[model samples]
Target: MPALITEAHDSTRLALSSHNPGAIEDFGLIGHKVAALADLAQNYTNSAIDSSELNRLITEHFPWWNDSTLRYFPWMRWPFKVMKDPSTYLKMLRHKVGIVIPAGDGNARETAHLITTLRNVHKCKLPIDIAYVGDGDMSPSIRAFLSRLGTNVNFIDLTQVFDNTLIQLKGYSSKPFAILASRYPRTILLDSDAVFFANPDDIFSMYQSLKETGLLFFHDRTVENGNTPVRQEWVGAQLKLAGRLPSAHLANNSLFFRHHIDEEADAALVAVDKSKPDTYMAMVFACWMNTKHVRETVTYQRLFGDKDTYWLAAELTGVPYAFEPWSSARLAQEPLIDKGFPLVAPVENNLARGPAAQVLEGASKPVSQASPTIAAEVLSDEKEAKSIKLLATDTSSSYDKNQTTSRVEAPHSTNELNFPRSSHNREFHDSPKPITPNRRCTTHMVHPHPDGSEPLWANGGLWLDKRDRGLGLANWTHWYVGSRNDEALKTFCETSLPTDSPNSKSWLTSEDGEQWHNEVMNTQPRWYSNDWGMDAEGCPQFEEWRWQSLNQGFRDRLERMIEEVRKVEAAWVLELG
Candidate 1:
């Protein structure tokens, strides 16, 4: 092997020194220009050589190429002229692989988790190298953990390099900056949160296919809308701002393959370092490179969507890409396999359990039997209409009087009776009563066996229909439970608290029950108002009534709206907090 000619650490100095008249430069005064010219000549020579002689030489010495010359670039070609032989350059490229991972103070737990998981679970046939760049002191715990993985890993502190510039520009904590800075050609930059979901053989295979194409970028399924040709202009603007590439190229960075190592590529990398060392700049740089001669690829997985701001940066960059379907419909069509590996398992225990679960549990309950008395009384027409009128006339009074009392007397209340405390209570106090016009009743029957056991229902069991009243009560309870202010607290106890379930009455307590209720109420409503916004005229009522309802009727309509807002808030909090 020809001895490797390592380039200077300062690439700009190397470029400048190559043209300096005073000191001698090893690669000659022309620097990269000379290298480019030499490559052109070698390519020309290889192309012109006689086929018969060339075939004989290649067969005897380079049997790998006997099958196809297209597989190997001609050594006498334009690009190969700088190198002594094409095989030598190709060997150098093949042996070196770039590995990247993000690290920092907040991300340490997740980052460590990812590294450990990758080391233990992911089995790669190739002896791939690993590189980690992040912020903060290299924790001995993480360093030692990674060392045990049986791979050579390099750690670079991003904060030391940027001098807080990155902190000011993008406000990203150090870990992400280091990862973006250390990216090299022909390397795979994996995010700390990204677990190896499958054997990456095909992923690597795709990378190899882009060898001639320059850089390869993975397409996220969710962010593909930004990858459309029209979005390329926006991507180009970012690249131009970074001074890496002129307008016309775009790139994204969920997953990417870097092919060619050139000055422009180097410039792209530096641009990423200087201009907000986040995923977007990296994406823009990639797009700028692709506009020249880079190749890009994307998977069909929806998991790759650019739903986040970092993802937005990538979509702006125009590059060759593909997207894999990870959408609900697509996932349903081709379900995941449950292999021994954690990646394909049905339950991913590796992910951190977020606060959402706690919030959900505190706010919700599984389907259970509705109180028999309320079911019967509420179902009756004369009693039901009277309750509706009461609600319409004075919702606050009806809610406050009934919410706690109904829960306490759940077993005795009947479908024909209005809840005892409200104004409508007298109408159904003792009557079997006619069914309400629009109101529906649902019955839930519990059976007891003989042998002194409870008796089962002989005829068709209790029928239960949708309950708007119950939902309204639940919403009110939630609002009060989540009370950050006096009004919300009042609303929860008086308007939203469920009247049918005695267990739900705990929402009125001053203990952990109240805390749980408040968090659930607070989280969803604030998230919705900030993300979706309520109209000004009804904003106060919207805010108040939003948390008071827990009925299927209200939940079915608002669940998606709530989730969307929550997701946006969650994304911001995860990165910012």
Candidate 2:
């Protein structure tokens, strides 16, 4: 219960960090945190502490650690120099959560729609901070219009808060800025186009994962060759150079150093607690990755924009973070109302409907378990090719062409997967030889509530197709998903915070933690980094998949949300009219 502002106040004052000058003159803000850290460091002055203990404590208090005590993973290698911790500082620090969304000229319409949906449909009461680059991106007229439109909304200008001298506010980089700039201790960061079936206010309460780690990032779809050489080498080098220790998250990440897994992080919706020293440091590093020099040099070119930086920073900082156990999924071009959607989507676990049943043809699927990560259990029996080619065709052409004139045999599921669907999909899939489905057809990334009860949200807007807006409102319900190997994740995934201490860091470096870390890393399924996390373009296409369909109740809820957002947009002022 320390009232601490973990932001780099000392660094910003030095005029060395990218934050503005004299960011927080009030030393009172970090008073308790400083006192607590001092007591811990002074009390633990035993000369014989091991490298593991040293690294753990450094992450515990940061800046308070003595650089001379380097047993392993030298904190000095990635030092916390004068970084401006998002120019804004909170006077009182407590366990509170709020929302941060990046908005401006590019997505003003969607921003309006999102705000309306959050306030009206889900009825989320969380305060929202709408962060834009500057007045240029957030025109005064647009700001006025949004203020008049939204409730509990605050605006933050990145240029004004962080020192824009080094980094330009490109859309990709704005995520970290908005997140760090939030006044709340915990931040729910979202892209304007995000559509949620559940109330965001329920986020801090619904999942055990969020309570345990304060930082939960969702995954990108599982695609082959996701680990590329350039990204792999860079991250690998950084990890090695820093002499980083192995943690369970690294083994479970999309880019597991060696290209064994996928290669991305979906930023559409991210949850983080900046009050934690480890997480605060991770955000600073993530922000630096988006800065002009770093981003232009290797971040964007090697990785997929700013998507992967969040986890990578956490990994490098040696902080505890979580990516939901479930694999990423997406909506079909149409709703379950048609054969095209059900035929190609992961086999829905619900009873099939009229036209949708015509295609499945009564090959009823088994009822899938209520498990959160069903990607592996529901995957096709086919040993999909490691690589598939992507066509440059537009969304309009792909869905239309796949729907008409083509009737496909469903890919067999690995388990008793039928909840509703008569069978699995033929499009964007493998197993039915000669006909290659578009594995790269995944566009709108999806994440479900860990319990599989309802969709938490999906990125890329509510439009049926972002590429072809004319198709009308999208009712994306089904998902093709994957998850990390369960056996490997059991050790670190959603582990309860150690009861003895306020945070998990205390016992993490103790004898039991050290033993557990060693046992888990050695026993995990795959233990090689032969493949880099990714190449310039991570995957040509991906293959293995599972299907999870929301129930009719969710579908009904989705329709209501879509209709509500549309109404909000209908009243929106595009040009200050």
Q: Quick one: best lDDT, which candidate?
A: 2
What TM-score does each of the candidates earn? Answer: 0.31, 0.60
Candidate 1 stretches with Cα past 4 Å from truth are 1-90, 125-138, 159-184, 207-209, 221-577
lDDT agreement of model 1 with the native: 0.27
lDDT of 1 by residue, 230-297 (tens): 23333333344323442222221111111000001101011121111122223422222222111112
Span of 10 residues, lowest total lDDT, candidate 1: 326-335
Error of 2 at 480 (Å): 3.1
Model 2 lDDT-worst window of ten: 384-393
Alpha-carbon RMSD of each model? 25.5, 17.0
Q: After superposition, how far is residue 232 of candidate 1 from its true place, in Å?
A: 7.4
